[model samples]
Target: MDEFRFIDSIKPSYYRQSSVIKGVGDDGAVIQPNIGHELVISTDTMVDQIHFNLNNMSLEDVGYRVMVANISDLAAMGSSPLYYIVNISAPNSVTNEDLLYVYQGMNDIASQYRMDLIGGDTTSGHDLVISVTVFGNVSPKKKRLRSSAQIGDIVFTTGYLGEAGYGLSLLDSHKHDKLNYFVQRHIRPQPRVDFVRVTTNVNRICLNDVSDGISSELNEIANASNVSIEIDWDKVPIHKDMNHLEHSRLKQLALSAGEDFELVGTCSKGDWKLVRSLCEKDDIKVTEIGKVINRGEEPSVYLNEFGEKLSLDQSGYQHGNS
Candidate 1:
């Protein structure tokens, strides 16, 4: 299969958008955004063995994961996904059929979010690699930030944590059949794009998607916003399937297990009430797990379990860290 044939084969009408004046066949994509909307862009790259293993994830899963990872970044900024460009580096071992399956997976989710595929490059490489760059839009007034958290703000997270990590563990141990939910969570993590679209419209929401673990995300918010944070252990929403695990183990996964793709952030208590109320109407579960505090004598992030405080270890998937 040649490169041009491969491109033409996966091209679909759903990837076309009014905003995209020209896409795919052109030398470069041409896009025109609405008058009052600001563009938001994010890019993510995944390597075969480093980010995924064919033994555990199929080609479709790999493509879907790369797309979701990039979209999650847009969601963190309170934006709506608009368009995307995907670049692939495939080895000789990968077939055109396999590549089509990957594109099919990407298109399935892209259709759900109303995102279009623009243009990108494909090349030969020693290992399979997928790189996705996503474009989104947000109203200037409604854009959220990690550096906007305030003292006395309430911290919150969407859905359950630890499920993706537990899923990865199951995959590693080849126990995927034991827990379908956890396994699915690992391979098919959902981004909180809809949640952000609804909640951040009210403003005063400082949020980020938990791609690197909630612990690292909280610390980032604290450092960026120059505030301290205290998370209540009991309030952290661990998946029910993880109930069989020890409390300490559950806590560790909930805090440091990356790739959950759930939103975690803060809002003023008053704004939180409105956000929570609006999210509930959409059937989105938002849990208040912690609070922002003045940076007086406390660490950036700490865990509070039944009034016992412990320092949170901001250790997750850091590449090259042995």
Candidate 2:
């Protein structure tokens, strides 16, 4: 179908939020910001084969993946999702029905978070591309930032890591026997938005979503906060499915492979205790991986493996690096 028809076809019957004054079928989307809250916005773009491969993932899965990528950023900021805008384009080979599936995919995940679909452009392109911008709100008092970590703070993670990257590998190798858990993680990973919403009552928590892997996120926290961080290799959580992988390879996946989308953060000891209990009560696995320290001139992340202290480089998925 054409662009206007595609846009009109996916417009919601009703907006999820009353704050959305003008959504689809408009020159611009107008939103009313809530009082006593700051807006948290995040956007992500996914290319055809680079970000996703249709061999293993469907267009709808791509839509959900892109939407989650942005929502996960809001989760890292401890914000609640409010609205989203999706811009999609594909080549002539893709039918209107295909685009419908894409929009259906976006709606599938977004509706769960009470996010309203706002305005975005739709047009033809050389490749199937999807861009999503998510908007959320956070209380100014409970801001969670990468630079908010403190010395003596405890490092923690919301859930298991490296599954998504491993999942992609499993898909690439056509390992159907071991595909269910990891494949789902690769295509339809859930953001830890609820965990943050429940456990962020604490005053200070430094958070980075594991979109780019734990090492990258940890280094970001350390650099942003100007503090050194050390996490034991044995403490990092990996799935039982990955236990058979070689030592260094498994650790590398857990440390450097990206797209897991878990939340890694630091908070004070008391605050960590409180959040740990709260997370358990909510049935979310929260693990104490290590602690923040002051041993380095330049802020850096160190992973303790085989009793050896090794500095962690910014090792994760970097677009266009390959």
Candidate 3:
């Protein structure tokens, strides 16, 4: 939940690199020095109480999340992750063995993605926290942006919505499960890097990771592109465990709940067959809930099922919330 507020405070030397890359503005930064190679950079921070609780979170899961969060940013930009830098801050209450386990978790996932750990920083703090910065490579023209969404582009989401949010609901309800699949997602959410790798060849015009839930992501895209979104509430996919009642609230949950780290994107109508084929080959479910529209003067979200334009009470979870 750590925020970046200091362009002039953190490091003034990065100013030179800012022009070369789309720095400190977009979901991730970009650098396209060569015509053939473009560089992508993104950073994420998880703090003790803001992002996770140490009493419930395992050291390994925290470590894995340290890497996954950064990788998610790269995936959203339609780039391939190459390397990462991680910085850890922890209190003396954490043992050296615990920190080593965290590093081991980082190494394990980084290897899976073939990302090399180039460098990082470690320091003592009052609480446990992790910050990871990831670098990826993409073609200059191929780098997707949130603002690239066009009016008439179909909206799509990779995989189900509200599963992680549903998982949190269960934990809040005190119903622990032996499966623990959803809980792990909350702790160690898997970034859809493989999905990104395949979809990069498709017509994904604009893309963003659904970390802050689907509603907030859609709003971001809408605001960026200055278009309205009309999503089918029934079409919003839900996990099998989530029954009709749960599914009914999924529109609200998926829209407002944070930490559902799926890919939300826009594609042209012509690419439907190709996109569906890719989803089939990869065994990922994608649902088309809406289309970009220029009907309204102001950008808004409309729910077809409710037959009215819906308003969201929450804009995903913000930092420092209990």
Report, for every candidate in turn, its global Cα lDDT versus the true structure.
0.85, 0.87, 0.72
Q: What is the lDDT of residue 115 in candidate 2?
A: 93
TM-score of 1: 0.94
Q: On residues 194-305, what C-alpha lDDT tens digit does candidate 3 reach at each position? A: 7777777775568889888877788888787787776776777777766654444765566667677888888777776688788889888777878887847677656565
State the displacement of the C-alpha of residue 211, model 2, in Å, after optimal TM-score superposition.
0.7
Against the true structure, candidate 3 reaches a TM-score of 0.83
In what order do the candidates fall by TM-score, top score first? Answer: 2, 1, 3
lDDT of 3 at 313: 22
Q: Sum up the clashes in candidate 3.
A: 1
Which scores greater on lDDT, model 1 or model 2?
A: 2
The per-prediction CA RMSD against the true structure, in angstroms, equals 3.5, 3.5, 8.4
* Residue 125 displacement (Å), model 1: 0.7
Ranking by lDDT: 2, 1, 3
1 or 3: which has the higher lDDT? 1
- Poorest stretch of ten by lDDT in candidate 3: 1-10
Expressed as tens digits, the lDDT of each residue in 58-112 for candidate 1 is 8888888888898999999988899999999999988888898888888878888
